[model samples]
Target: MTAGLLPAPEDRSADQGVRVSRSHHAARKVEVTSPKGTRTWSASALTDHGLPSAARRAYEGAAEAMAATDPSCQLPWTLLAGVGRVESDHGRYGGSVLGENGVSHPLIIGVALNGAGPVAAIRDTDNGRLDRDTVWDRAVGPMQFIPSTWAGAARDGDGDGVESPNDIDDAALAAAAYLCSGSGSVLSESAMSAAIYRYNASDEYVALVMAMEEGYRTGVFIMPVSVTAEPSPDRAGNKGRPGRGHQNDGRKPGSGATSSTKPHGTPGGKPNQDDPSGPPPSGGGGNDDGGTPTPEPKPPKKPPKKPPAPATEKKVGTLAPCGATWCLDGWTLDLGGEATLAKAAAHDYNHNEVAGETNQQELDGLSGAKVSVVVSFGTATVLEIEGLPYP
Candidate 1:
């Protein structure tokens, strides 16, 4: 496993119920090899599968490439689909669309790896090249490869000549290579767990990915019904996805406490010092030291209030001329026009956040390009606009 490639776990507690869901799936196995040992799959399998078309293709292509190059690895496309589903929901996360070329538009960049809460801190390695932030490195693309790891393991799976983390084909291939770097076939449950654990050192993440992989391998993949669905009692506090942070109060998966500042509690162990959970601590809080004391059950505490919504948000989409000023949907940029947009911050064609008058002059030409703009107080301002045909 690479040092800085440990991305934050994602929030997928809602889908934990698949373990006990309806088991009848017609028992169909996805084909992965032909008589010649080359990878192959039916078009109906790809079309009817839950994964998006581009993402499925990328996963299968990566598996095929790995099968030909490293025959001993035995990489399956379903494992990649499981990772992609948990990582970025097959590149449909945050309303981002996966292009025909396996590139996710607006880019599925994970939260900053600034060591905040349960997240691992990784200082800027690519200088805001892959992820837009220079202060901290983030997981990029459908497979969510960190900048440093992507720099080392990037591969041009789509034959695009350029190796980009934003491209799902490259990211999936890179992920397959990383998984196969170690010995053992990932088709086996134990080997698959070990391989996934290397990807993100969390047991819950491995379990979730395995569950998803099993479902995909069979035809009974049960996705989350809704975002509001709660985690099962067994998975309770261990709510997280593949390549992002936990949705719990900044807690790592399987940990009993809200924060990792203190000792983490295990099953039947002492409660954490930060947030005491499970049973009462030893002899205190109703469990008397002596006698069969009749301890009254305490009422459940009220759930914590959710944080207020942010006043401003970054809106990502295509931008076009709305009368005089540039607009995306109903929102219009406060800039006078392409000429007045010079002062706003922007990123060059390579997605690198640039500065100075030279970069500012290039902003005038982005009339109909895809962009990310900060919308606040009913006024939209360009933050980091993608330049030209998109990298």
Candidate 2:
């Protein structure tokens, strides 16, 4: 039973749309690439996030710590995975990778926070130590921890004792600790959302993360797509950010994870006590401390996994319309899972906003073009779209 999305939006909850309960499969020793480096994970669920083994392992550790720290909180691994995906694409940013030692060789640093516009403004907390700015601090590592917050919350996640921010294992622990600090339980949807809002300073950001997390958890990636009159040159990748039906919106993704609005030394960001959407108006998703150029270091490792053999790539949909042709603009749709073009979203990212048909009547002609599709074991919801020009 497939159905299109409602134009007005119903629950406004992130858990809407296709849901994949869980995968019951044996663990495979697969290696994946991240900003830190290629590492192996013994767990099957962790690898489904399209993340390298190292990142998944770090996230597993983080979720474990959070659960242990607060049994009532029971934080899920996908929340942190969502954060990692949004913040730095599983630490694969800047062409870096997680080393076997847990260090993000070459380092993962964000732009300087100049206090102008959306970026937060905080002076240097550490003098040329963690981020090496000595002036203003930059969010560091896979989880993007600000120096000010990292100073007090940084833990030896790998048990190496040095408490290095470059280590993904260590960073995961610190991030989990911060998420659980506000005395809030991430168990409930509302409470979990509130916790995510504290991490970044925007409601949109939280939604994007939660959406991605759901996909990772269920192994069903949702790719939101739009059909346009004119050709879109920016097809291979998004203009500013990554993923579907979402954009940066001039606000940093995780700026408020540990903003100044909260009492100093606390891991939690400026919690939106009132909105559960983002940081305080004056704070939250602002810039980092300041701007200073930091040259990243590269390392030798097996590059990220390549697409599987063409023979392995599966395709859905009947050629029944006989010669119907389809054009796709987003990332390559991986047809490795039990997927099919099942329903039309009735809307997608249009004019930079979610635009769609209001009723079935409005979508009259689209039925002929609608092709139920799905891709298993990959990321993306709305990938390949088939249509015919107006008659």
Candidate 3:
């Protein structure tokens, strides 16, 4: 026997308006424009940190090697730099130097122990313990190597035999190798995120790394959108099952499948109906022996109707300042002000701010506008802007 069909549930009441929170609305408004085109993004998208000088050099050398060895391998240098920034704070660890006697020497160490020299010195008493030395082993060097994991993964990135943890060049090379090796070599956005998780071993590490990576890539830090806003039911023409308040089975009208009763006067069309071709009918419109007449030929099937368009509200603009420019929608407004430029930089605009530059001078004299400023470490640019009264 054929199974009975289940009825679909009723759709949720639209009268009970879905109240979108302010934060959700704000998050949806944030977006970034790249070569791939404009995309919606959250505020936590990119990070503003940088790699230590030592680590940066190491990463460059390693990237060059990878490029030479594997043409298809592509390591995002800026992403690596951003990772370094969050991991080691550009290798500004305060510690004492170690002498030839193997005793700890006292001296506050920054990015370099001396010019082009290996970082040495231990500022904290727990220098020997990886967990206790927050400035040294805690954060490690460029690529943010954990002291516990460094021994197994560290390598000489510059082709020099020595592998120093605090050396930026060595650290960066090690990071690149780690990222491009084993499960990390794929270089997908997800893979990069997973590799970062391996580096930190934190559940949230991927989100942090992605945010920083994206910031370096596009000069904007955005958050991820929540999944709640998407419609629960799959609409017609969508590539999934129509859920909940829709057709329970694949059966739809005009799909060539039988539903309810067949067209009238078409005998034997319904299940268990007797065959009309074998004998004449006993009705009044008879043939030879008082049989009914045959019915007309079946008509051609019609195409299915198109589904209604999904409802969409007008998208509001987000406030993003880069350098001398602020962006909203597709428009950009330039506001030439050092304070404004600095604010944009503080917020992680993807350019640098340098004195005596044309853009810097331009920023020194602007007013009445929202702007998107892209500032690197040393140079700033007015990428775009909007909503400004300035001429």
Which whole-number lDDT from 0 to 100 does residue 135 have in model 1? 96
* lDDT, candidates in the order shown: 0.53, 0.46, 0.36
Tell me the spans in candidate 3 whose CA falls farther than 4 Å from its real position. Answer: 1-55, 69-73, 93-139, 183-185, 223-391
Q: Per-residue alpha-carbon lDDT of model 1 for 115-226, expressed as tens digits?
A: 5434566789988988889898877888878787676467888987888888999889888876675454777656676676556543334444665676667645432210
Tell me how far the alpha carbon of residue 122 in candidate 3 is from the true structure, in angstroms, after superposition.
20
> Residue 167's C-alpha lDDT in candidate 3?
59
C-alpha RMSD for every candidate: 18.8, 26.9, 26.2
Best by lDDT: 1
- Candidate that would win on TM-score: 1
Q: How many residue pairs clash in each candidate?
A: 6, 29, 53
TM-scores, all candidates, are 0.49, 0.47, 0.35
lDDT of 3 by residue, 85-177 (tens): 444333432233323221123321222111111122223333545334444333344344445445544666655667655556666766665
Worst lDDT run of 10 residues, candidate 1, spans 32-41
The lDDT of model 3 is 0.36
